[model samples]
Target: MNAHTKGKARSTRVKEGMTVKVVRGQHKGKQAKVSEVNTKKSTVYLEGIEATRRDGQKAPIPIHTSNLFVEAQK
Candidate 1:
């Protein structure tokens, strides 16, 4: 497995479609659902919150797990 895949396998506890809140970044304090978990890319897609190329303009992207804190309530 690649480094990205290995890392994700180790770090991620929650699966896709879970709710997560951005703890850091321009979108900080924003809540979004976990869209996709890319172990090979070590990236998680938070639907409707991540930076996108719009009107040919770029904005600061959402934070990664390093900058994110998952709030899981039992």
Candidate 2:
């Protein structure tokens, strides 16, 4: 179980518009401004972190906060 299971992630220090870096996962080391925060799922959407969909549209992935580190606030 992860921190989300314990519901501690709902109180994450990271907030929307903050600068963050991916500390883990395939996106590791990528830093960007936070676009949104989904406390319900403990995920954060970053401005520069996205994947190109098959339809040729770019979409932001919902990364768990556990894989992110707040670099600064925007």
lDDT of each: 0.64, 0.87
Superposition error at 2 for model 1 (Å): 32
Worst 10 residues of 1 by lDDT: 58-67
What would the TM-scores of all predictions be? 0.58, 0.79
Candidate 1, residues 1-74, lDDT tens digits: the string is 68786655334465577777777767778777777776665566777864557687644443456666676522
- Residue 40's C-alpha lDDT in candidate 2? 94
Error of 2 at 21 (Å): 0.8
lDDT string, candidate 2, 23-72, tens digits = 99999999999898898998999997899999999999999999988777
Clashes of each: 0, 0
- Lowest-lDDT window of 10 residues in candidate 2? 4-13
Predicted model with the maximum lDDT? 2
